[model samples]
Target: MKHQHCRKAGNVLMIVGLVVMVSSIIFSVLNQLPSIQMPALLAQGAILGIFIGALLWLAGARVSGRERIEDRYFWHRHYDERCRRTPHH
Candidate 1:
């Protein structure tokens, strides 16, 4: 389903974001010299990755449909009532 695909893509984005963040941290720590400046893009990568990943994940969840407890309960109640109203087929 489209929802499943979106969810999977979102999960991949999140994982990629985490990897970027970790790598940036490691790179910065390894080059912590008084005379050196960290690469601007390296820092940006972590931020962009995390922000974009979270957004994508949220979008995917929206597309996938809400899974709230109240929603489930309401749906169940509606289904039961509908079933009761229908004549046996």
Candidate 2:
């Protein structure tokens, strides 16, 4: 269904965002080393990647339906707990 597709796309975006962000940070750190002497383009690219990754992550979080599912689980558990505590006549 369309819902499943959206969820899948969100998951992919989240994964790619995380990967890009982490890799960019690692490369940026490597660029700081004396022996590496990385080009200025690397620094610019890393910054750009980090920004894009953050946007993708935020977008994915918004698109994903996980929060609703978690809310459902939370309410179900709460109701169950409250019911168990009250003795039925």
Which is the leading candidate under TM-score? 2
For candidate 2, lDDT tens digit of each residue in 1-89? 48888899888888989999998998888988899888999888998889889888877766777667777777766666664556545
- The regions of model 2 sitting more than 4 angstroms off are 67-89
Q: Give the per-residue lDDT of model 1 (tens digit) for 1-89.
A: 68678667656655665665566566666456667676878656655655665565555445545435457777766666664556445
Runs of candidate 1 with Cα error greater than 4 angstroms are 33-89
Index of the highest-lDDT prediction:
2
Candidate 2 versus the native: TM-score?
A: 0.69
Q: What Cα-based lDDT does every candidate model obtain? A: 0.60, 0.82
Please give the clash total of every predicted structure, in order: 0, 0
Task: Indicate the residue-level lDDT of 47 in model 2.
Answer: 83
Give every collision pair in model 2.
Answer: none
